[model samples]
Target: MSVSIDISGLSHERIHVVPSPLAELGMALHALSEPGHHPGLQGWATAVSTRLDPCLADRLCEADFLWRSTFSDVFAPFAGLPGQSTLPGATLAEELDQLDKLTDEQFVDAALEFTCQSTYSEPDRNLLADPAVQRRALDLAAARGPQQVKFTQRLLDEPPVVRAWLRKLLEDCDEAFFADTWARLSHQLAADARLKTDLLRRKGLAEALKALSGAVSLDESEQLITVDKITTGRTTTGSGGLVLVPTSLGWPHVMVLHRKGWQACITYPISAPGLTAPPTVEQLTRRMAALAHPVRMRLCRHLARGSYTTSELADAHGMTAPEISRHLSVLKKADLITTRRRGRYVQHQLDISVVSRLGSDFIEGVLR
Candidate 1:
C-alpha cells in the first residue's frame, strides 16, 4: 500500500520545506506513548518521561486517541481550524494561539475526524448528531480502551470541554518539556529545511523527493511521488500545492496529510545531530553477528531482489521452514530486514539502507 501524489503540475515554488513545532510536539507525544517503538529517541523520551508532571502525564494518557490515530489530524498544519495559519513558518506560540481560537464546533470536528475508525468511510461533520454512527464510533473506541471511550464521549457530548481540555493539555506540555525540547530541535530543523531547499533548487524535484527518505520515490513517467505507507490513496496537489515539513521526533514514520479543506503536506523525519545516540558496541556486534552466518548472508542477497515469504525462502535455500525462520529472526533482531503482511502470508524484505550503512557505521564505531 502506498500514497501516490500527483505532482505533474507542481512547480518548484510549490514545494516547501518548513519546520513545524506543532507536528514535532505531536510526534513527541507519540514517542512518549510508545517509547519502546522509537529506540532512537528512547534516551530523550526516558528523560522527558521523568520530568513530566503527573497531572500532565495523565492528561496526555487520556488523549491517547489523538496520537494513537493513524493520522493525528488535530496537530496537522492548515487543518482548516478557524484562524489557523497556512504559511511556511509559524512559531509554537503562534500555532498554540491558533488552537486556542478554535470554536467548539471546529475543535469537535477536528477531533472527530482524527478519531474516526472507518477505513473506507469519510468522516461526517454531523457524526455526533447521528445516533447510530455515534454509537458505532463509541463502541469501537470502547474496544480500544477506556481512555478512548471517554475521549469519544467527551468529543460527542461536551465539545466545549474537550476543546478547552485539549488546549490546556497542549499548554501544559509546553510548560512541562516541549518548550525546551523545541528550542533544542529548532536550529537543527531549520538547518535541515535549508539543506532540503538547496537540494530542491540544485537537483530539482525528482532528486529532492528521492532524497527525502527511503520510503519516498518519484516516478517521472507517472508524474507521481509515491510514499510507501500502510494506507493507500491518491491525491493531487491541487491549487494549494504541497508542503514538506521536517520533524525530528517523527522518526520511522512519515505522515502524509491530504485531507479535504487542508493543504497537502508530508511530515518527514530529519536527522538531528547530538540528539540520537550512536550505536553502542552491543548493537554493532549484534548486526555483525547476524550477518556472519553463511545462510543469513545468502538470505540477505535473495531478499535484496524482492520480498519473499518464509516458505518461499526455505524452498530457495533448500532448508526447512523452521530453519529459515530462525535465520530470519536473527536478521530481524539486527534490523537488517523488515516484514509486511500480505493477505495470509508475511513477506520479509531486506532493509538495504541499513545494510548499506554498515561499513561507515563500523568505521565510526571504531573511531569513537
Candidate 2:
C-alpha cells in the first residue's frame, strides 16, 4: 500500500540523517545468517563466516520467516530514533534486562503480530484455559511452524528467556563480525550524514527529503508526501517529523517504521565505489591512485576554488578541452569531484568530503 502524508505544517527541520552501527550490524548478521537467500552478499558471508561462532548460527534460526520475528525481539523499532537507542550504552545483558521489563502479554502480543495467524485459533491444551491466552501461544507456534517448529516452541516454553537467548546470539554473531564491518561501512554512513546535512543547509528540507528515495516525493501544492514501500497511517510517516538513517546494510533496501514516543524513520541503503564488499580501506587506495596524476591533482585544486566549466578550466590550465574533459572524468570516477550540466555547459565542483575522508576514521595501517 502507498503512504500519503501531509507534511505542510510539520517541522521538516526535525529531520535527522545519521548512521547506526548497531542497526547495520543487525542487518549484517541477518544477511550472513541467511546467505542462501542473498547471492549478492556471498562476499560478506564468506568474510563473516570465518569468525562466527558455529553454535550461534543454530540459535539464530535459519528459517527466514521465523528469523525476522526473532530479530525484532532484539532490534525492535521503537518510537524514538536510534539516537535514543539503548544499544549505545547498554551491553547485551543490559539490553536483555530491558526486555525483562516487558510484560508477558506485551511480548506475546508483539510476537503474534509479526506472523500469520489464519491457521490457528488457540494455545495448547495445558497452558491456560483463557481463550485469549491460548491464542497467543498457538499464534506464536503457527507463525513459525511452516519454517521451524522448534524455535517457536522454545519461545513458548521459556518466554522470558527468549530475549536472553537472542542477546547471546547477537553477542556471538556480532562479536565475530561487527568491528570490521563497521570499520568498512562507517565511511559511507558518515558521508551520507554529512552530505544530507550539507544538502539541508544549501537546499532546505524539502529538496533534501526528496533526494532520499526515487519512490518518495513531496507534493508542495498540497503539502503531501507519497512515499514508497510504506502504508498510510503507520508509525510516524507523516505525523509531524521524521528521521533519515543511512546504512550500507540498507544499500539495497529501505525500511520505514513508526512507534509511539519514538522518531518515525526511514532507512535507506548507501554504496561506496570499489568498497561494496567491506574493508573500505581499499577505497583509500583507489582515491590515492586517482590523485596520483598531476593533471587530476591540478583539476582538483582549480575546482576547489569554485565550480568551473571544462572550457574555463582548459583555458586557465592551458590544456585542450578534450584533455580537461578526460581529467574531469577521472576525478569524477575517484569521487573527488562531482559534475552537473548547467544547460549546455557542464559544471564541475569538488566533493570536499572525500578530501577530508568524509570525516571518518583514517585507515590506520592499510595505506603506507
Which prediction has the highest lDDT against the true structure? 1
| Residues 232-287 of candidate 2: C-alpha lDDT, one tens digit per residue | 34333444466566767644445554433334556666653232222266666677
Residue 61 lDDT in model 1? 78
Off by over 4 Å in 2: 4-9, 36-38, 62-130, 133-137, 140-143, 146-150, 153-159, 230-240, 259-262, 272-368
**Candidate models: Cα lDDT each:** 0.73, 0.56
lDDT of 1 by residue, 169-235 (tens): 8878988999999999999999998999999999887887777788888898888889886456777
Cα miss at 299, model 1 (Å)? Answer: 21
* lDDT value for model 1: 0.73
lDDT of 1 at 29: 86
The TM-score of predicted model 1 comes to: 0.71
> Among all windows of ten consecutive residues in candidate 1, which has the lowest summed lDDT?
114-123
